[model samples]
Target: MSDTTTTVDRAKRGRSGSVILTDRRCGKRVANRTKIYDRRCPGLYVSIIPAGVATLSFKFTDPGTGKQRSTTLGIFNPETFTVEHARSRVYALKALDPAALVNQLR
Candidate 1:
């Protein structure tokens, strides 16, 4: 298995910017966009799609066996799903399994 990391800027003219990862080998993409109101708190805000919603999803991979898995972080809730919440979830997952959050790229 191979590990690749990518960052994309989805900052539209009047939209928030997003950073994502593109997994070349497995062809998966994960969105890692965070909103920063002040410079002091990095990644204080995060956005995630709500659960049980029809939206794009992020894939996580196992580093030991090199198996790919996908899970729904949340549904797209612009108001409820803040950047900090998303980041916290990601961090929590990472703590549980560091290799479980390998966002696949398309």
Candidate 2:
């Protein structure tokens, strides 16, 4: 296979394939999964519960406490908001001044 084809294949399979995830052969739901990271963006992830609910989440450090934290961004839906939305939100968060983010958190 070509290099592009191999790369696409790898992404479809994911590294773990812990859950079948969407069908690699064809776009279809195979099973409810958990914890899938976006390779294109650090700190962005999606988790699928057994009931098939998916949520978008982002990991960051709390400036006030100097502790790491994760926040749920929104419901993750391919038709609605997905990885791209999470990545954009993370980017926006990174652009903020530390104090502003803490204030918003309050």
Candidate 3:
């Protein structure tokens, strides 16, 4: 038998560190934007689109299928979102049951 496993970033694997404003801004300006997960909060990340639009997102694993799942929290822009707000959102989302979340997807 063969085994296959997909691992996310080390920081995302567990509580690693907190995300700062500079990190988020840099991600938005990068040519090839990728997900920048908050080390202090598991499953919380910022996704910067090609046009420099940054969005707050949450990632979690579904217990039933053992697969990763994600959802958008809000937009991370100067007039709208902030790191504190994002952290609070993450706290709220973390309290939800994974199974319930999966069912909602269906």
Q: Give the winner by lDDT.
A: 3
**What is candidate 2's lDDT per residue for 1-106, written digit by digit as tens?**
6555433555556434333233121222336465766666666666666666677777778887899888888876677775567678888877889878756545
Instruction: State candidate 1's TM-score.
Output: 0.36
> Model 3 segments beyond 4 Å from truth?
1-28, 103-106
TM-score attained by model 3: 0.64
Quote the positional error of residue 61 for candidate 1 in Å: 1.3
lDDT of 3 by residue, 74-93 (tens): 88766567766887877876
Q: Tell me the lDDT of candidate 3.
A: 0.69
Query: By summed lDDT, which 10 consecutive residues of candidate 2 come out lowest?
Result: 19-28
List the global CA lDDT of all models. Answer: 0.40, 0.64, 0.69
TM-score-wise, the better of 2 and 3 is 3
TM-score, one value per model: 0.36, 0.63, 0.64
lDDT of 2 at 7: 38
> For residue 63, what is the lDDT in candidate 3?
84
